[model samples]
Target: MFIAAYVLTGCMHQPEPVVTPIQQLNTERYMGTWYEIVRMPTSFQRDMSHATASYRLNADGTFEVVNRGFNTRKGEWKTAVGKAKPIDGMPAGFSVSFQWPFSGGYYIAELGSNYEYAVIVSDSHDYFWLLAREPRLPRWLIDRTLARAHEWGFDIEQMIETKH
Candidate 1:
């Protein structure tokens, strides 16, 4: 009984998963449109294709976030307008709210030096997205980034390529 108790306690005390964002992010350069190259399946984005996100900085330093995608099943375009509030002292972190009073973490875990590509994750590491300035990225780069996501505890196998 003591052995079982010790094992159960150890299991309950496991550390939370860690995902580190880049040290710095230039919001200005990060603005504009980014095409979604791949992402973990999300209910709201089901059957989405040609997914894209646009960022515009507001006067108050928050960001106006617009996400668009073509729904294959519905044969129409869908868009969601939201706000991204940057977390002070966390250059790569933001709280994005699509539905008012309910926000989720938007962290840039990996970013290219030139801002050409970026890997995004939430604080819980449940949401993952691979974005690029262009519609498509080189196969090798995608593979490398996916590998990095795996290292960060993401389930890369569940990632679905976005059609653009």
Candidate 2:
């Protein structure tokens, strides 16, 4: 009776598995500026336009992220800074936080072979971002990437393209 009860309890309490990130990332190659192609809505990004995100490696082996964009309605440029620490066993995912003790999962689901583009999917599946090294990508590539994202179970239609 004790053994059966314990087994049943364990099965009911298992946590959801973490989504996998792209393997064997060259963090150095992944650094630098990436133009925001499209993104799923988030409170912080509401009312923003021409959005861009930049990454820089820190001496302490972490990373700094600067997200900037123009707020059309507000008629101003806005910027937000955050830091990310790499998660063990996940080469392309990090625990990112804009404020202390409040980190969120940042994972790269797909990346271009030449590091020209990347797709980031939040652990909660509530956020997604499509980014590229250039502000404008060829139409075919954008369509292809979005197709791939759809195959991977993300709602591609929910992503809104950025002006830049």
Residue lDDT tens for model 2, 101-143: 4566677878998999887776554567788899988888878
Model 1, range 53-162, lDDT digits (tens) per residue?
89999999999888888999999998888877787677887777776445666778889999998888775555788999999999999999899888888888898999
- TM-score of each predicted structure versus truth: 0.88, 0.85
Q: Pick by lDDT: which candidate is best?
A: 1
TM-score of 1: 0.88
C-alpha positional error of residue 54 in candidate 2 after TM-score superposition, expressed in Å = 0.9
Candidate no. 2 TM-score = 0.85
